[model samples]
Target: MSDFPSIPRLTSSKYFSSLLLLRNIWKGGDLSDDMQFQRVVNQRTYKGELILFAFDLCSVSDALNAVLMLRHVGFEHFLPLTDGAATCEALHALADVKALPTTPCFWSSSSNNHKGWDTWGAGAGCVSGERRRGYCKAEQLWAIRYHVAARLLASRVNLLHMDTDTVIFNDIYTRLKRKPISDYSLILLPESPVNGGLWYAQHTSLDSGAQWVIAEVARRTWEVISLRIRRRSSPPFDQAMLADALVSAMKGERHVAYMCEHPAVALQPPCANASQSRCAYRHYEWVVATLDARNATPLYRACFWRGDAIVTTDEHVIARKQRLVAVH
Candidate 1:
């Protein structure tokens, strides 16, 4: 008999607690025996990797994309953010179809579990105004994501938090090795003038202070950032807050921020109507158009989220499905 504990071990979460990174709000709970994370010492084989991925799958299309990622762009191991049964199934089924050899197990955030009480407090007074509920809920969801991502920082694992909407064409690992993220506290690329789509944080020791900076960002938006959708400018979401926290922590010195522009490092499909005017995720036609245009370019990495857009409501994922069919 194996003398191992029967808990899904989350390395980063444990590291965070060990470092005392949660100076104020870290909550310690009894590990659930029903479904515990599979344990490994660090869960990473190499000492350092340029890009190890973590993806969120909360919807059907997101699952499809996870399959796409595994088939097209190989990932060693990733932190997964799955909010429900469908998302979980899709990730599990990834290896079964398309000649994938094995069903990969992954570590995930505890918040993905269902709740009886109102965990978010009606989106937490984060965003106020008429029609703000939807936006606020989105913010809260992302807040949890950041909260989860912080564990990776605590575990001292370099993580590239990519949305499922993003695609990869070129071999990114080979490229990043040419110019590594060794010096960067965070690797950020502007999705827009005021927004970012992807982030990379290096693995650092408990004393490096990088963990403190990442912790502050998560703490500020622990549950919500409340960036209203109607505003022309960004409304202080987690990305902005993270940038601000890093800036403050770095104290005007080099942020060690490797700011790579999109389309150069990777491809970010413009909204179908982008040539005419800017479009939000609500613009279904624009979303569909971007979906149609995905494979047109030789993209390196694709950041599919549009300014923190909602994943499910957009009707365009249907188009993405059709594209997959045609590929088959």
Candidate 2:
């Protein structure tokens, strides 16, 4: 196991206040129809509680704005995870969510000038399947290793890990239920069976069963990335690592559950007006423009086509662009 340190607890009121201000600035001066938005948000935010973990790069305004929009629609309790004092304060100001300290990340700006780039070590040779691009291999190894360690150290906390690009349209907790008291140990993307897009786990105590599963996955990802280190330079295929680990865990003694749901339909691009249940799943489908042929970003126009079109967006291009630009 890697010896990366776990995230330290925060003790600064100043830092907390700053994150709060940054959050407020991100919100701008928009009026919220709490009732209307709440109706939409209520589906996910039940009293049992759900935690949203978004990893923010330099600025988290985009993800936090997603939280605010979810709140205006009526879902609250979105948390922003950060690695700096300034970032923490900025996020807190904009929303009534928790601001947790950042854990060890894949690569900070400082590593750009480091010597490990060209050197090969056991760390560099971990990739076993498809090769990975340069630098990214080391990054995946470090990220998964550190994140697992951090989760181990955080007592009594259940973590839900998410990338920054996603937005929440419903109360995520309500959809996930396993006997109510014992929630799912792992929840993953439905489209991808082998890999997980989101992860849910209790961090207070290490489950030997769970640890075995996490470690195996991390190891597989490292192998896939490292095997290619001698060939290609860099690859953004961390998801593949996740897939390998998850598949291994299922095959092993510790059978962690993977849940897949049709991501909420109302969250889809506006023009893809297809009903939620009717949507189909399409892999790696990219459209430069919407089905209507109007302009849209890859994600807004691009969709995972399920039978009839399960996942669609209603957000216009201008508004989505504004949201993207408004992030700090």
Candidate 3:
């Protein structure tokens, strides 16, 4: 038996039932009371793919820089999701003044409260001082992300969700198109052990294996954010939980396993290196493959300077990012 907590069946959980209601509500074209979300989605979606990222007031600058970088790289279809009205208004203002083609969507206060959780401040990491508070906000944001992704998947919309800290140098959709979409449910980007900061999801049925994986991740994330269980000393963030969930899903008899052959487009083979024992693993249908770090560089490296299309790491401090942008 796996050491991780057992995932409750989706059909039996009230949380999942709410997501189902949301899925149905969205299907009827009533995405939100304001109808702004539907309008944004309709305008931003490109070649059946939508790029998404979420941010709050504290991270608005980084989000704007990210948007600018993405646009600079010839990407036209992207949406920014924010929980705070202030953040949404700021993004709209900046986009309008800058003549940015993309519009942002705001979630009402009924959906989430941006003020309840403490902000990470300028130079702090997610689990900096007051680990519990920071972790709580991080967990909550991730839960919201998964919830949104689930709704999108239910509506049969393909999406690539990325973090604001990440920088793009090329078109990611063209790279993804190299693979056969029918063969995989999700494609992850490797960050040291693993990362949830960047990933791609294909449109899947409500009951498909991929949806089950997403539900399991969301379930665990919600458990942490809701305080249904006590927080552990070494808390597992969404990325770690996602990695574990993928491993567990792979162990199931119904899930088929495949070896990744192309390191650039898919995950490197398990035996690619003898020193990294964790790198040696098989992928299941739930997570078909991983995008190599060379193409999607994580924070620890300087792959952007070396010509990667996407770099996943960014300075947490606003001043640092601003200085770098000024110099560039």
Candidate 4:
């Protein structure tokens, strides 16, 4: 886990005031709707209830299971993001309709978002079915999460961002409740150098500058996948981009840094807008089969995957996926 320095919390008064000010600044009294944009421009966060969420494009099973399993542990209302082509394709999977919270994710590239995230999300390795590292679904989801937390949900009490693939063996939220969310800004679990599988951060815990640093990192993730790092030696790829975001970026003289930190998360996909029920599953099979073919684990789960590859309950998943790839 990365070391975190102590910092002041946002305090509800300050944060709410900032929100009102932001509304005014952006709206400019143009009589815009309370929720300005559909796909993340001005969606109001449900700040009343402190939220817990995880995202996936090709990993709905994992995401939904995370929500259900977490309910067994501590988190009662964990949300699964309906972002990316996969989840949107599987919008009403099983009995998760009531349990799953609504989200304002762009999901697909339909919002006229010029980012062309759909193309950028696939990466070179994903297309070629090779083990070479190129930004893929995980980084895309992370970038989207960062945008939601910092931009839309900035006024929320706390956000517990978990990875869908993880099988929670312990009561993380119970342990987290030991301290107020403000006490720890960024929650990091031991063994995760990059993705942390799960992350916890309070809106108030971080200063705007620190938040922007992370936002910038997410933006950088959009660039074409490359083996070379940036001038200042930014993290090698999207994984490293997140690590640096947590640490802080050297953006000119306004160096924003993390205000609070904790050791607490395990780190652990995307698709086009084709609406076939099997769209996401089909894409995910090829994407993950490549990793399995190479016996590779993503950088986010390097330690955990290496440790747990032998004894596993999830072995069946990969087996099923591999078979799926072979057939269609």
> Could you say which candidate leads in lDDT?
3
Across 240-311, the per-residue lDDT of candidate 2 in tens digits comes to 434333332323322111111212212223214422221111232211111111111112322333442332
lDDT of 1 by residue, 1-328 (tens): 1122322223322121212211221111111222232132133223443232333343434644543453333343444443333334565565355444333333233442323113432323232122322432444445546655565556566555566565544333332322333333444432233233455556444424555555655565432222222223212355545544444342322221211111221121211122211121112111211111112221111222344322222111111221110000
Cα displacement (angstroms), candidate 1, residue 265, comes to 36
Q: Least accurate stretch of 10 residues (summed lDDT) in model 3?
A: 319-328
Show where candidate 2 strays beyond 4 Å.
Answer: 1-52, 55-59, 70-79, 82-156, 178-183, 193-195, 202-204, 208-212, 215-232, 253-328
Best by TM-score: 3
lDDT of 3: 0.45
* TM per candidate: 0.48, 0.40, 0.56, 0.46
> In candidate 3, what are the lDDT values of residues 1-328, reduced to their tens digit?
1111222222322112122112212211123444655554455565556677877656767777766655444454566665544456766676667765444444433224432222221111232222333323545556556766666665566777888976643334444444343345566553333466776776455645555556567665443333322223222456655654454354331111111121221232331431221321322111232322122111222111223322222322221121111000
Clashing pairs in 3: 270-280, 299-313
For model 3, state the Cα shift of residue 241 in Å: 2.2
Q: Which runs in model 4 stand beyond 4 Å of their true positions?
A: 1-57, 89-91, 96-112, 116-119, 123-138, 168-171, 179-182, 203-210, 222-236, 249-328
| Candidate 1, lDDT over the whole model | 0.35
List the RMSD of every prediction in angstroms.
16.3, 18.1, 16.5, 17.7
* lDDT string, candidate 4, 5-68, tens digits: 2211223222121232233222111111234322123322323323345454445555555544
The alpha-carbon root-mean-square deviation between model 4 and the true structure, to one decimal in Å, is 17.7
